[model samples]
Target: MAAIASSGVKPITGMLRRGLILDLSIALGLGFTFGSAFWYGYHMPRTNARDNFYKKLEEQRAAKAGN
Candidate 1:
């Protein structure tokens, strides 16, 4: 009787550990995907727009100085 009970417990423990690891891996993958999407969709566009604005302003200043 004791031997049978211990055998049952081992399988349950192993299944539980596998389930936990699967859940963690899925969470990590989702976090990386969302972070990349945010960096490309939101942050990069804003940074590019600001840089362009500065470049145009500098060009205008140079034109004014030339005159």
Candidate 2:
């Protein structure tokens, strides 16, 4: 009886540990993927646009100074 109960508990604990690891890996993977997508798709374009605007403004200033 003691051997049977111990055997049963071992498998249950092993399954629980595997399940926890799986859940954590999945959550981290999704977070990294979505975070990368958002950075490249949305944030980068806005940042590039702002940078371009500043460059154009600087060019305009240079042109005015030249005149």
- Compare the candidates by TM-score and give the number of the best one: 2
Best by lDDT: 2
Clashes of each: 0, 0
State each model's CA lDDT, in order: 0.91, 0.92
- Superposition TM-score, candidate 1 onto the true structure: 0.77
Which 10 residues in a row give candidate 2 its minimum summed lDDT?
A: 5-14
TM-scores for candidates 1 onward, in order: 0.77, 0.79
lDDT of 2: 0.92
lDDT of 1 at 45: 100
With a 3 Å backbone cut-off (N, CA, C), the pairs that clash in candidate 2 are none
